[model samples]
Target: MQKSITNQNQENIKGIIFMVSAVLILPFSDSIAKWLSSSYTTIQIAWLRFLIQAIILIILSFSLKYKITGFHKKFILVSIYISSSIVFLFWGLKYLPLANNIALFFIEPLVLTLLSVLILKEKLQKNHIIAVIIGLIGTLIIIRPNWSAYGMASIFPIVSAIFYALYLITLRQVSTKTNSKSLQFYIGVISTILLSVIIVVCELLNIDSFGFKQIDFNDWWLILLLGVITTIVQLLVSKAFFYSKASSLASFQYLEIISASILGWLIFKHIPDMLTIIGAIIVISSGLYLISHERKNSKT
Candidate 1:
């Protein structure tokens, strides 16, 4: 079916756009979260973030009569993995600089790519393999191998990478019949519910980690910004996965490092050293070429 191929090609192109936008914009959200972490507990920040995200998405998805319907049970697992990932990531962000936190988390793309092929049964073409490898090399160069110094903070991101990679894999498996908005809404809702239960349970059990402190109205704006960014990014990521293989989408994640670097320097005055800049250049060049190649092939 020529028409089918054409449709899939268009979807592939859109997928690339959506995935790239998600990765790039997500860093801004991460930057904000890192800044906020100093003033809030990770569980406190995470539960509230998911709540705001759920609220925003529920409003945006109001028109979808069946906004939270028909997803596989696997989505529950997806919610757990993602919530765990976020909790771990926020812990890392609180202790690590924005760029370093993001660099360490970049390992998710590699983990996702591996799971895509080995677990999801997606074909890993030579070019994709090359793209992911190049992306990692660039990421490693940026971090420059001083990971041990970050200590426990660094370990959190690694754990996050595993959870996030599993989250994406599970999401891809369950997104075939699901539209992006509804899927995003479902995740927001489920994740919100999951985190709420966790936070409450921690409180009931006399766990002091996520205790609710006196509220500050001032921080609501930052929380709103995070919700908006996360909601929109999740929409894009859901769309991307709806249109492309998990492995194909992973390479685009490297673009986040560049954004993280710029946002870090601008907001926190954490300048990127020479190696970071060079690594970013390598990542973008290879990523752009891969995108162009995919587009040309799709046209053919």
Candidate 2:
């Protein structure tokens, strides 16, 4: 019994470490995307990001001797949702501050809770309801809908969060049946194809923001780093989730917000306003409480 408890504790520690590493690494990719957004269209960036990821993942799969499997609807759906989330996030980053974008995206956990209740038919506790409300309030504070300069761009991250939440939900179902590398490879391939289609459509329609442009040498390096780092982060996060309960993993996600804030300050000299800061605190607190509450209920 003691040995079993010790192994469980070790797994929990490993999960926390992996999760923290993933969140830290993820901000770097977003920062690079924000930097590159000035030069490349969102669709173009998304296309390259997924394309490179797919290539690397294919190589990794072959090296590791993991056979590519048949088509699964869940994998395709997860890809679509994640691809949409990335496109929306990069679009928002083009206009919004990194901190603002991260703050808005932080509502994903709350969104996931609601999704669980609705789609998973999970019973919602009173604390979960309260946490969702508080989380929304925090997002609103950061957005400040009427006053923010970004205007409609502010809504993009919220949309990104929604898609990401759905991705997480879909991932939960698919992760059990698929190997992580194969799953990632398939999603990368599907997303690359989807972004390619979007880019072709945008070019045909002459949509300036979505139109493709020739990549420069500097941008090539950045895009490569974006894909590689993002792939690593995804693997780390997948391992983290495998080792820990979703509820326990939820709180550590806020680390991305902190890392984003630092990156924004260093790279862009952007700072959150008083209201945004207050909202972040509230959101973090509420999310932590929600996770702890869930953990307690599970224990009982």
Each model's lDDT: 0.84, 0.79
The sequence of per-residue lDDT tens digits that candidate 2 reaches over residues 17-48 is 78779987898999999999999988888888
Against the true structure, candidate 2 has what lDDT?
0.79
- In candidate 2, the residue pairs with backbone N, CA or C atoms under 3 Å apart (3 or more residues apart, or in different chains) clash, namely none
Model 2, position 287, has a per-residue lDDT of 57
Residue-wise C-alpha lDDT for candidate 1, range 60-155, written one tens digit per residue: 657545455576677788889988999999999998888888888888889999999899898888888888888889888887767478876788
Best by TM-score: 1
lDDT of 1 at 288: 82
**Highest lDDT among the candidates is held by which one?**
1
In model 1, the runs with Cα more than 4 Å from the true position are 1-4, 63-68
Q: Quickly count the clashes in candidate 2.
A: 0
